[model samples]
Target: MVLAGRLRVYLIALWIVGSGSNIVNAAGPVAETSTATIVENVSYQNITALPWREADHRFNYGPQSLQFGGLWLPESASADNPAPLVIFVHGGCWLSAYDIRHSYPLSTALADSGFAVWSIEYRRSGDPGGGWPGSLEDVIAGISHIRQLQDFSVDLERVVLTGHSAGGHLALLAAQHNDLPSLDAVVGLAAITDISEYALGDNGCQKAAAGFMGGSSLQAPAAYEQAQISVDKLPSTVSLLHGEQDSIVPLTQSDGFEHHRLPRAGHFDWLHPQTPAYRLLINRLEHYLPEHTP
Candidate 1:
């Protein structure tokens, strides 16, 4: 829970009001559903400004030909060095409008803090390029790819999955089944955590979630189920960080999510950035991950 993390939630909340609500129609030929064709040699816009010390690629389940890239922060040789891996997924409400470029800063920050980082970029929504389960597939692929690489410097055993907004939603959705090699922890930063509540009206994000899910919950029950970020899907030891004032994806989303979650599933830490609660939450997180190392 960094100071910037709190600021991010607050800022996105303000934009939720002004953002227009409209579903984007398909743009080009729809890419194969569940069939991910990796765009090879594709360079990510290195927005981190941090010197890229080292990077590599591994296709978890998609085309190995695609040249996807990610950074690797190796642990210190000393025994005291922390052994943890953090994978960051970017948020764009499942649209191509946003990409991994925006997450570089956060990845860099995590790397500087001694945690190995993987900032992923997946095919986004709006037809042609990507949509629906495609984004979810890519996320699973990215994590699996990392796991398949035997020589990856980061400790796969202590891995933590993290995301902001839509990425947060995906992170939560990913946790539902305990399917992928079993992540140690899941963290959502002001994530789009609840689908049913968000789609009730016409805020920009609500509209995006509705369209991304392919219609109202009633019309697309299956799609809604697939995209739902309910607490039941979350891991037993998940960590969620959000500003109480977040408007884009209201804080209530997190509240509503926990409302239905089984007590044994997990407990959420809802921190307000405007108060001392933010620092306390981060302190708890720092210890929480280490304390709950499974």
Candidate 2:
């Protein structure tokens, strides 16, 4: 665990310094408290301690080569006892370089907690027919593919959509587009809510944002308008969680939307089961779970 943690820290440091240069961009004029001290005071643990437990099944949603594929984490379930489901979308700055593999630990942990998990992979900005409407379309299709799992003992009415980073953006967008009446709630971990603001900023994901949307908000006004979240269109309650010390995607990105801010937490802290942020997430999710009459 210690070795893995060190490796993760090394990798993250390299990523920020190497590929993710805009990770430290200023949070614009957003009102933020003094949490900068926490950045230096905090000690990060390697959150990827758990090995990747292979999914029970893999399902393909569309005909396109990049259009399909989802990892299913099925906990014990019976016809009389159907497990609730969580459709998880991963974040990689909306790029094809990042995929759903990084989220295995979270998916495994959630499944261990008794909720069936579907960690999905979709076409990203680099792939052909990816980005903009294509990526968004894949998210919607992936969530809807839950219906094909009728053979599995799943309670569709207790479904939840949880996403991280770019995936969080897709999750919120999917909730607006998909036809899931049973979507009890949407949980976004360090989610990107405002695309136009993000594109205009100098964040690590700024360039990818433009790429994902097909161009600048001005160049692709229709795409930005279509993908941006409209609170009025949300089908379920939205719960956002962001780390106070997150420099990659600042806490301000979640501004305008109420979110649970974790002190001394960083971007990937929510994915670590041992972190307080993850516990907070589980607690929030408990309210939406089906009650048992013991």
Candidate 3:
């Protein structure tokens, strides 16, 4: 058992070092500097610099009039072809305070990279009928609503799902549902995979888990079970990217899954287009795309 445990730790170290090397190579001149220094030099202000699409269409997917919306950004689409689609979900601890607006930068960046982006805004804990099944339901509904975009130049077969934090958790969970369309790949950035473990911890987001689920795991075992993403149920080629220095969501949240760990990156680093973490994320996205795609 000790030997096995030691091997696991060794493998994790190798993975972290390998990921660091890739980040360094992708970061150019910054590769010569220390990881901490490179991270320190990254500008946080750039996240909000790019303006999102001025018009985002809102749709009511459910009966409560609790509408969900998608901000669509298509990279140039010709009459003969449609761009691939990427559905982005934002994270705000499953609360209304944190909406889809925070994801605008990342969505716009993806759009600029020659892809169509559908940034989703769903109901959250503070909203009436929000929480547990409601938030999850909204995500499923939003994705399903993609079928309604037939008129738009979107390649449905190449659709990918990407999310961060709470949204990451939702994206991962949504990928597991057989009812949803088969996804080409699912990318989670600092996602919360273990609902039970998260609710039991003392982290700042811990209490929000209870609020989102409506009770403790012990109090609502069935709900927690439904919300949790089992390792075996993950999409075949799921890519999880997380930061070693993230304080909001612990790295252990992605314990059982194969994930790439950035040396000194934080929770919000994934959202910034200028960070190495974002570069690694784009590489991962490109890896799953068809080779013929530009």
Ranking of candidates on TM-score, top first: 2, 3, 1
Q: Please say which candidate is ahead in TM-score: 1 or 2.
A: 2
Clashing pairs in 1: 13-247, 13-248, 40-66, 40-67, 41-67, 60-145
Please provide, for model 2 over 1-294, each residue's C-alpha lDDT reduced to its tens digit, 9 standing for 90 to 100.
Answer: 010211111112213311543222121222222112212212222433333355778888888776655545444667878778888888878888666666766776676667778778899988887898888889888888888887887777788888988899998888886475468899899898889888887766766799889899999999899888877787648888998887667677787776788888878877776667777777877777664446
**In terms of TM-score, how similar is model 2 to the real structure?**
0.82
Query: Which tens-of-lDDT digit does each residue in 41-66 have in candidate 1?
Result: 11112122212222334232465322
Q: Which candidate leads in TM-score? A: 2
Q: lDDT at 36 for candidate 1? A: 23
What local lDDT does model 2 show for residue 263? 84
Clashes of each: 6, 1, 0
Stretches of candidate 2 exceeding 4 Å from the true structure: 1-49, 69-71
Better of 1 and 2 by lDDT: 2
Alpha carbon deviation, residue 33, candidate 3 (Å): 25
lDDT of each: 0.55, 0.72, 0.71
Span of ten consecutive residues with least summed lDDT in model 3: 1-10
Minimum summed lDDT over a 10-residue window in model 1 is located at 5-14
